[model samples]
Target: NGVMNLSIKDIQGEMLIVSQFTLQAKTAKGNRPSYIKAAKPDISVPLYEAFCKSMETHLEKEVKTGVFGADMQVALINDGPVTIWMDSKEKDY
Candidate 1:
């Protein structure tokens, strides 16, 4: 994965993984969104932990993560104005 090519350890960078079920939410009908595609806790929790562990293994450093199914507040300060989006299926970024 080109995104992972960067040496985060060398740069002393920190990572945060948030369980964003809204990514799978469907908003086709009305104002309310449906979460039919999002995995239930039984499925998503293990996968999410596996992902965080994988990141830690790859980076050789601890990776931070948010609560799996909690209402939480997040504050982020943009170090730069650039934003890049990548899709695994496309892999064209």
Candidate 2:
């Protein structure tokens, strides 16, 4: 539904996605990140786009995002209905 305007990569191995969808991605080699071998636009891109669509729908709002193909740290914070409204008064922190 959408295209990644950015890129995603792991310089080290410290990146920890709680869902770990990439863990199960198929590859030519054995169990590894298989990033290089990962034919992204062929597979991951569509899925990523679909995820974006479903995600925005589920949230019922336009989720702010970065260019997926761009090198950046990706961490999804699953905050369920944690809506906060700001005002001139400090009624709620």
lDDT of each: 0.86, 0.50
Q: Which stretches of candidate 1 lie over 4 Å from their true place?
A: 1-7, 90-93
Model 1: lDDT of residue 5:
66
> Model 2, stretches more than 4 Å misplaced?
1-33, 36-39, 73-93
Residue pairs in clash, model 2: 5-67, 6-67, 6-68, 6-69, 6-70, 7-68, 7-69, 7-70
Per-model TM-score versus the true fold? 0.81, 0.39
Q: How many clashes show up in model 2? A: 8
Clash totals for all candidate models: 0, 8
Clashing residue pairs for model 1: none
Best by lDDT: 1
